[model samples]
Target: MSETADSLIEVLREQCLIQGQNGIKGLSVVFRAMDIDYSKRIVYEELKIALEKFGLLMSENYLRTLFNALDLNDSGGIDFCEFMHKLRPSLKQCRIDVINEAFEKLDVNKDEAIMIDDLQVIYSTNAKQHPKFISGEWTEEQVLRNFLDSIDTPGNPDGKVTREEFMNYYAGVSVTVDDDSYFDLMMRACYGLPIRGS
Candidate 1:
């Protein structure tokens, strides 16, 4: 990454850490507004306008360079995960371990990606603890689908989630949570994993 890009990422990361969930929410709103096509990926033109919208006036050269740096995949646009990852500080090793453990539990078939089938198996095993299932507002399938949708790549609900998507989703959540143990507990509780001492 260019120094400018790195600096910007640091600034954004610090701001989000200080503001917590509100900072993340504000960034989401900005991304949504900038994605004029609603494709969930910000193209060069869209990014240019977004910069201006935020009162940032950048020369054409600098803007292009920054955009290229953010587009890690060379896919010609920056997806929401990529954008957020750039702005969020790295998670601690403990947080990563817990996240991976939860992901492994969800990836029932040993596939690197979590699919609807995996969700079906896992959710069925834990359905009694699911609020939506207990309240009768959603069937087991509905609960699984909604959970998948919540974490799926933005604007591409393909009914599957890659590990990167899962990590990035939690990266956003990690900023909101200040403590590592709390995050671990949150994941364990949400996924019905046994508590640490148990």
Candidate 2:
């Protein structure tokens, strides 16, 4: 990881620190809401905090362990070839030719890869909707619930957005996400607009 990547990690570490000051016992919900399990997940945001908590950058093992998961072929080593092959589709879909600082900034949770949670956060934060992103006054549960509700899968009287539903549902309108307003994410989810950005 370079300086930009390190800065991305640092940002996430701070989020964990602020949320988990009471320790893991209290932080579990927030972590799950962010869609990461400490034991199995190895996202950049989580890893950044791990580096801080474990005093990363200073330790070789922590860095090694974080990237070790990318050794999908189990070759005992990871090279550029393998990484590019695996990440090409996602990178393309996300509209990135290379993973750079912008990608890091988009990854609010500090996880290297952007999951649905990360996107939802960015969508909500940038849209400036549902209060939490702007004010940071709600509980983790409240924030997650509000987002899920805002993006609830259509065709149900009560709003319910499951992982399967999120991927499978189609929105009725064409949405240009770069200029998407809060109404854009909200109405798209409610009306089932074809999702554009990740």
Q: Give each prediction's root-mean-square deviation over alpha carbons.
A: 3.9, 16.8
Worst 10 residues of 2 by lDDT: 167-176
> What does the lDDT read for residue 116 in candidate 1?
78
TM-score of each: 0.73, 0.21
Q: Report clash pairs, candidate 1.
A: none
- Top-scoring candidate (lDDT): 1
Error of 1 at 112 (Å): 1.2
lDDT of 2 by residue, 1-198 (tens): 455434543443444344332222123233333334324234545534544554335345445544554456555543333332332212122222112333454356764443446656655453355566458777555665565554343212133443332322111111212333543455445434455575
- Each model's lDDT comes to 0.77, 0.39
- Model 1 clash number: 0
lDDT tens digits, residues 1-198, model 1? 678877755755566557654455455566778887778799998878866764566779877877887899999998877786676568899888888888999999988989879987887767556898899987888878888977876545679988877887787788778888899999999888889878
